[model samples]
Target: MKVSSMDESGKYDKANERLAQVKEEVGKVMVGQEDVIEQVLISILCDGNILLESNPGMGKTKMISTISKVLGLEFSRIQNTPDLMPSDITGTHIVDESADTTDFVFQKGPIFANMILADEINRATPKTQSALLEAMQEKQVTVGNNSYSLDDPFFLMATQNPIEQEGTYPLPEAQRDRFMMKVELDYPSLEEENKIVDRFTSELDFEPELENVISRSSLIRLQEFTRKVPIANDLREKAVNIASATREKEELDYGASPRASMNIVLASKARALIEGRNHVSEKDIKEVAKPVLRHRIGLSFQAEKQGMNEDKIIDQIIEQQ
Candidate 1:
């Protein structure tokens, strides 16, 4: 429901409180990276996939698994490697020999769960990587003749090690566009690292008992509410213009598509909701623009030689808008 009246405003406040609880619960197991956590939540609220890039041992898997537990969603993990096959992600039909006769039964893969963590996704082959396209876009998998629908509230978070490129196959542009955001996980600060060391090393098996902050139905309702958050006309126009300017810039060889524009606005709306605001703001758009557009745009050789990165280029585009 839209938050147009005072009654609806109270509902919005209550949802925000619950979402805050979700963050707090996640913080128990996770350290810093507050922005990263917020972006992941925003992507979930939009019902979109995520591409996480970071160095090894950055707690990407731990962060995702913890969020799944706190949200009361089923979580599955797939470790992608060079030998990983398409059937490994999407289930294959197996022969089941029962008492009466032998029959083919479909075994669902990890993709059937509510939250999936695809670790080291770039390590998989191109063919294997392409297998995720149908599921990410359509939320279903086609084996031979029959298609199986995935569970509701399905979310995929694929992580790739940015420092390694030896045996990795970079994701194609089409597949990258399917992700709503490409969140970069950076190294924690000195204090945050100290806290991480104490939190994990102090206990033998430091597994914090995280309570279910948001139930399944509550999460689904929050996803619906995220779309109802309002944005001003000027801010919406600015979001569009920021995306459009990417195409016109000479520093970039390729620009983002209309999907980038749509994601920018949608992500801004979700960010507003997460920040306990009923209306989208310019700061929200600016904050979400980098992650939304970073992976979608390509830089020219000159820009690369000039030591310019996607985030830097995106910042320039935002300023122009």
Candidate 2:
């Protein structure tokens, strides 16, 4: 069913209500970082994973919890530690001779949920990190020759401490590329922080209750709509060119993968839906360029020494359009 043909007024009302519902749900637990929450939701609704890089004490955990609650999805959080093992996240097969002598039962891990918050992902070793990354890419975990697919609306929101370097394992380029967006969650404004303080201190330390306005099936439908959303030939080329500039441009050593193009296209569709548009526009592409493309592009040591940043390179590509 077309977005336009399916009860236009009703769909719009529902969409808007869902948007507001998510915002209100997140706002209840979080004092601010509304934009971060919105972007994270966009990624989730688009069936994509997100990488949120911020310092400590940024309420990343609370935000993920609130979103899971509002969406009525099973939520799981894994505190990624250096000593974390693959079996710890992907589960393992242990023969329980005491309970059942003949059968080996599968012990499920935290990745089995619909919504997963990989808190402090950088703290985990790369081997353990790949366990979650594989699930993010395949949406399934394999153990002892058996595979288990994760539930639908399976979303991973990983948080990292950008400032902390001690005993942290930063995500490599290949792993980073899997994420649809690398969102930066900064400190809230002074007014927002003050409100956070007042609310947390005054309230019972519990977030507001959120109504489940959207369903997992409806979310899947929305993702399908995003795939069907029309993109003009020119806009498609623009997206391609923007991706090409990342690798071919002189400032960078490596370019973004085909995954980046996919992200740009899907994220633009999600943006249009949020803005009540049936078709995607270049404006939507431009809006998502930075967050979608920043981490995908790699800078040379010379460029880094020269203080050239990803945003600057993306700005140049945007100016070309």
- Model 2, residue 300: C-alpha shift (Å): 1.1
Cα-based RMSD of the predictions, in order?
A: 1.7, 2.2
Off by over 4 Å in 1: 1-4
Assess the local accuracy of residue 259 in candidate 1 as a C-alpha lDDT between 0 and 100: 95
Worst 10 residues of 2 by lDDT: 8-17
Assess candidate 2 and give its lDDT. Answer: 0.84
Candidate number achieving the greatest TM-score relative to the actual structure: 1
lDDT tens digits by residue: candidate 1, 38-70: 999999999999999998899999999999999
Best by lDDT: 1
The models' CA-based lDDT, in order, is 0.92, 0.84
Candidate 2 C-alpha lDDT tens digits along 65-144 = 88888787889999998899999998888777776356778989999999999999999998998888778899999887
* Residue 50 local lDDT, model 1: 97
